[model samples]
Target chain A: MSGIELKNVTKRYKENKFEITALENVSVQVKAGEFVAIVGPSGSGKSTFLSIAGALLKPTEGSIMINNQNITDFDEKQLSSVRLNQIGFILQTANLIPYLTVLDQLLIVKKMQGTVTKEDKAFALELLKDLGLENKEKKYPNECSGGERQRVAIARSFMNDPDIILADEPTSSLDTDRGHEVVQQMAEQVKTRNKAAIMVTHDERMLSYCDRVYRIVDGKLSEEVRTQEV
Target chain B: MGLALKELLYSKGRFIMIGLIIVLISWLVFILSGLGTGLSTLSTGVLSEAEYSGIVLEEGSEFSLSKSSVNRSLTEKVSEQEGVTDTTPMSIFRNSVRKEGAEDAEDKITDIVLIGLEPDSFMEPNIIKGEAWSNSDENQVIADESLENDGYKIGDTVVLDNTDKELTIVGFTENKTLYHQSALYLPMENFQNLRPSSPDDADVEETVSGIVVQGTDVNLETFLEDEENVEYGTKEETIEGIPGYVAENATIMLMLWFLMIISAFILGVFFYVLTNQKTNQFGVLKAIGGSNGFIIRSVISQVFILSLVSILVGIGLTYLTVLALPESMPFYLESNMVIIYSLVLLAISVLSSLFSVAKITKIDPLTALGRAE
Candidate 1:
């Protein structure tokens, strides 16, 4: 209840006056301490569901609740506030700002709301140390490897202490070993910090870190029974 | 502010290049403004800096103060006119002078312009050294300080060409020039006696070239309408009548305005392109809960700091350049003009970044939703 919930959310785009549904009646509840993975092929409405769930886009129908507050009727500015205070996002390929240092990458999350206090800086540094980014705080994103940059992005997502962490293919830019390391860090942070996390990834090898897996075919969403490898 | 400062510091090369261009542009702006102000002051400071508003010249002389001559008694009549505050009968004579005991080779060494007005009148330039003129009957002169560069010194006796009359330099003054030639201040009675071309039969004490008139333009014009062989002009109009003043001022000011316009456009486009280059980053910031207000503030802070620093440096450069120039150049830069131009340049530069702010507002955080890192 203190995480993110989407109730029968549907998103449609009007293409040349003909409606194309990107998502249809998808209901998902990611509670505190849960790591959920939504996997599907390209153009399978995975991004639309995540965009709605993160409050970056509004659904044509149905409501979203974050920390038990309904966000469906919220305006654009209100939605942005929800994104800032309640949601944390880790986009594909680390999506780190090139000009910012690793530590600033984390602190910028706190800076967006107001002045970043000393405690906020200590917390950011602690998060970096916890994620194995010690001695890399002053280094820029370009100076770090793809795996290290992705880890910084993970640390940045958790910097605001948001209730829900949304990651869209965070490991897509890394190789197998580094990709596994980045997802492992994300899952470890979710369970240890008691934060809800939803990662949308196509790489099946990374699904081992998720507590629940949901598959999307076309615009429909349904849960897949947690299965073992062949 | 944190993000803005971080980005500016992180990308020093790009912003420095842009900042350097701004520095040069603002430098040019300040230089041009200084030159424009310098030329105007050089041409018209004798009139504008004086307390009186206008002058009366003989009508047939066509606003040429040198050729105009009038009855000194008209000073009293002009003072009685409506709205007239005061009047001083004055004379301007173009002359060449030499210091006493100079050899023939040094003859005509200084082109001396003599301005004849009452010693304590509004037309008298405040002397920076030596004594003010004390007698209307005795020969006394307050030479411009520029004369020092030409080897003329205070208390030295000056001898005019074609005549043996000696006018002793009594003091030195600053910023007095007419028709691009430095002037020496002297009393009206002595100017009448010492003029080289005066006819022997003329009453030197009863004649003047013009009257320095102080009053509202309307009353002056009305007084002029009723008068014969004379016309009235405000100080600004009198300045325009100075040879080469208007034409030189127009060209320099035209270029100054054009430079400002171009600088504004260049600065605006630079910021716009800068914002365009980072629209993806801005989008990402928005996506992860960074609001438009935060992003706008960052962009504004970046632009304001760059402009402020660049303009300040430019002004400093301008002052340095002014100091490096020779003293003979007509280059006078006032503190007020510097302040005004700096503020204008700073404001336009900051305003230029608003286009980028507008672009920032339109950036959809949804573009940040799944952007490839």
Candidate 2:
């Protein structure tokens, strides 16, 4: 309840006359201070589950509870508030706004919430330093390398200190070495800050950095046994 | 708001192109408006100078001062009517003038409108130099300042066309013209002697073209009902009734209004396309918990800023044109008219930006998350 919990979540799409189910009776829980990874092939409903957990998509036939509040029936405006205050999204391909520099990328989230302060600026600067992007603060997304862009995006996710973090394919556009480095930074932040994170990826090389891993196959979700140390 | 400004500053080249388009459209509108006013002024300058409350013309004269004929008896009758404080009988006839000794050739002749009025009537010229005529003498007239270009000076004699009588120019007034011809002020008697009497009447004392009346609270309808064969109209209405006046104004105004409407649509389409190009960006913002109002405010603020800056630049360009224009050219732009035009343009721009705002409201966050197929 302090993090994110899904109960019998199901998502279906109706196209003309045929009804297609993207997720069926999927239930998952991620506690505080936990790093979870969802791995599956394309079109396997991993993105659907992550979207529902992040409150971006509504479950067709179940409930989602974040911090003990039932969010399945929340209106769009209320859902937006929930997403802003409780959830953080790290989209695929390091989705930093093109015109914003690395530091502005993190500051913009605080600005959106109308809570920007001097302390917030210092915290953003400190987060960039922790991600090894201290000197890249003034560089735009186009100026930064792929790995640096991803690091700025990770820093942005922690800007608001939300209770839940949902990252979708955060390493899809990076090289293997840079991808592993980015995942390790995110793992360290999640553990050190006592926050819950759910990452959806298809790369098996990034799974060792996550404490728990799940695989979704054809609208069904199943947990995978961990064979390596975090 | 910050986001909008930052994006505009970063994308200076794109926004500058849009600003230049706005400038071109606004410049066209302002210049056309000035010309339209100038054309009306050219046709009605003398009549407007009369500043009379009402003008009475024969019913069938079609509001043309030259064609209107009124007897001296009717002028007296109008002065006795209720609310009629003063009445002046005047005549406007087209004639040519030349230096007294010059031959009657095309190059030596200048077309002029002979305006005959009482010596001290309200229609008397405001003499800027020399002295006004002291009496209704047959050999004295006041020439418009344009005649100075023809080498005429005070006390100089100019021969009237179709008559051997030569009139001495006693004074010069400001640029006063009618139907694009320079005006010459003369006494009513002198005006009558120069032209042939009406073919149907032999009495020269019964001749006059129209009556200009000044009074308080003069009702045009009541005046028309009291008189049998005369039409009464205010000065503005009379000017509008000039030949080709209504049609010319209507045509130019129609084109001006159409251009403004087209500019509004152009702005709408431009903003719409820009918004469409950023649909994916808006979607991502929405998915990240940005409210619809937030995105809408940003877009409207961008439009407001763009319109303000571009319209100011457009007005500045128009001012530059006014400064560069030649003095002889017929172009007049009033400040109030320009301000009204700018306000209407800004309103249209704000209205057009709503199209982009509505598009932002419909963007689904699901699409941005890659969850929807």
Top candidate, metric TM-score: 1
- Candidate 1 lDDT (Cα, 0 to 1): 0.85
lDDT of 1 by residue, A70-174 (tens): 999998899999888889989887778998989888888888988889999999999999899999999988899999988998998899999999999888889
Looking at model 2, what is the TM-score of chain A? 0.97
For each candidate, report its DockQ versus the true two-chain complex.
0.69, 0.44
Q: Which residue pairs show backbone clashes in model 1?
A: none
lDDT of 1 at B230: 89
Native contact fraction of candidate 2? 0.43
Q: Give the per-residue lDDT of model 2 (tens digit) for A1-230.
A: 58999999999999999998999898889999999999899999988898889888898999999998899999999998888788888888777788777888888788778867999999999999999998899998899999998888888888889999889999988999999999999999998888899999999999998889999998999999766675
- Per-candidate TM equals 0.88, 0.86
**Tens-place lDDT digits, model 1, residues B1-373:** 7788888888999999989988999899888888787777766666656777777888867666777888888888889887778789889888878887774884656786788887667788897889887765558898877787677887899887668678888888877777667788888777877776546856667878889888764376566777888887666777777777889889998998899889889999999999999988998899888889999998999988888888889989998999897777767778898888888888888988888888999998887765554
